[model samples]
Target: MFKKAFFAGIPVAILCLGLLTGSCQSTGTNKRDKEGFTAIFDGKTLQGWEGDPTYWRVEEGALVGEITPTTLLKTNSFIIWKGGTPADFEFKGSFRITTDGNTGINYRSEQLTDIPFALKGYQADIDGKIRYTGQNYEERGRTTLAYRGEKVTVNTQQNAADPESFRANVKNNAWQARQVTGSLGSSDSLQTFIKSNDWNDFHLIIKGNRLLHYVNGKLMSDVTDNDTVNRKMQGLLGVQVHVGPPMKVQYRNLRIKQL
Candidate 1:
């Protein structure tokens, strides 16, 4: 009777172990699928990215880009992600920049083989000076499409006579600005939301020709691109280490979900 009882218990123990392993695997998958986003950075290495090793690396679980005075670039360089090109998606990340550092998240961009890791397209600007931070900029293209706290509708057919004309058009439509309320009254108010030398959360949402940039949970810029002639629908994604001064920018918790 004792031998029969011990043999029967072995099968029960095996079944319990299998159930525990299956439960753990399911939990991990659910955690990664939270909010329908997947992490782009592994927090260990630059395995799925392409860039000059001299300027980009993983440090302390963050993707770090640094340029010393001795290694100043003649033109902006980027670390391009080799992952799939996302047409419509939401990107979320946390960043910290030095006082002299200038960086950006470039999306829907194209690479320039002539310049070695050079990218040109839409850039969600980031700067330590707080001047261009939270703006929608086109790299090597149309330049600043929208500034902080401005809601802009770009009519590619309407050619402005000068820079002032373009600025006037954007401001005239200020009443249409999205996500401006309470603490986020104006562009200056948005600037106050930035932490400067400390970490700040950035969110970029793009669907079709519309783009929105948010910093620290505040909407900083809104753009509706009507430039069908030159606008990009899809391209590469990259992070920039701008040319000039010794500076460092660190990014972590990078994730995106294609919509």
Candidate 2:
């Protein structure tokens, strides 16, 4: 009777062992798709993401972010990711503006938080004047207002500098696609560009600290890692809803492919 009982339980033991080993590895990581890529946003919900829930929404099949009056979405503080090392790859998504201007997104972030990072890293920008498109700030990044001495000048040429340039490019608030390919260099230096009206694609290749920002298939910002100390950038991927009039925006088809 004892021998018969032990033999009968063999199949059950094998199944249990398989279940335990399978779950352990996938719990902290994502499997690559058949296209040899792994998707970040699931397209329907904010799974594998944690942050100020008030900052984002999943509405009518779109991943949305907005700025509420008297509210700091702090969407620019963290990224929702599958468990894995921050991989260097191409990030692409479709977006539409629905607010009172001033909006941007961050990439190649090292972590998540509200503290200023000095000469630590860089953020790829998204500027839609009616929705805060191309304005890059050193939010806990290397550049601080207090540290800007007497003759320091802020660079605002990345996203047309003003609304007129933004309005002239967008057509009746249409949906536009944007992309950033972060290719780091051996040194950890970086730079990025933007595209708004057109279905523009920017390729960012980061090989270590070295980075590049290509806009609408053009080289816009070619900067390197300068140990000069600019805090507020780099650390975690985040979306920014500037302190301004209330606004809303929609995004979809978000995908990431490691290179």
Q: TM-score for each prediction?
A: 0.79, 0.53
Tens-digit per-residue lDDT, 138-253, candidate 2:
34343221110111223323343245553443333310111222322211121122334333344444444344444345443343343222222223344444445677666665
Candidate lDDT (C-alpha), each: 0.75, 0.40
lDDT of 1 by residue, 98-188 (tens): 9999999999999986777789999999999998899888887667777787777765534443564544444432312223222325778
True lDDT of residue 201, candidate 1: 98
Kindly provide the TM-score of model 1 when superposed on the true structure, using C-alpha atoms: 0.79
In candidate 1, stretches whose alpha carbon ends up further than 4 angstroms from where it belongs are: 1-31, 158-184
Query: Total clashes, candidate 2?
Result: 51
**Model 2 poorest ten-residue lDDT run:** 1-10
Model 2's TM-score against the true structure: 0.53
Model 1, 152: alpha-carbon shift in Å?
A: 0.5
